[model samples]
Target: MSTANERARMTDLALQEWGVVVGILAERGESWPDTDVTRWGPGVTAAMERTRALCAACSIVGATEAADIGRLADLYEARTRS
Candidate 1:
């Protein structure tokens, strides 16, 4: 049984992995990109649920501290430019 801290860590890791995967996909600029839900729907959904469940365990308090979101936005811009 994972404790709240353990679950939060797992969720963080999962989010990081997803970010990396999305970054790679964005870099490739695929013509027919599959939706994230379709590709890893179950896992993504699970991770999100876990993250929400462990929301209190999250270290970051607000949007201002969300560097990952900024990174994702940059990736989106790069994809559009290419």
Candidate 2:
């Protein structure tokens, strides 16, 4: 069995991986454009919300590893955001 700290590290990896995936999905969501499918669509928005939840959960991990992922993601996101 893994030690407590090792398990915690695994959890942090999971959270941060989810965070990066969430960021990717969020980036893809931006390309949908202002079409009827984007504006009048419930499914697309629901998916976006679900994807965002991964990132939200990452914040709750509160681990240094997860935080590092968030920081890296933020820097990557900044390039895209600009």
The lDDT for every candidate, in the order shown, is: 0.44, 0.47
Q: Over the stretch 13-61, how does candidate 2's per-residue lDDT look in tens digits?
A: 5444545455444555643223344353555555545534544544465
Candidate 1 C-alpha lDDT tens digits along 1-75? 446565445445534554554555555452123545455545445654453433333334322222243433354
Off by over 4 Å in 1: 31-82
User: Model 2: runs farther than 4 Å from truth?
Assistant: 30-82
| C-alpha RMSD in Å of predicted model 2 compared with the true structure | 7.5
Query: Who wins the TM-score comparison?
Result: 1
User: How do all models score by TM-score?
Assistant: 0.38, 0.36
Pairs in steric clash, model 1: none
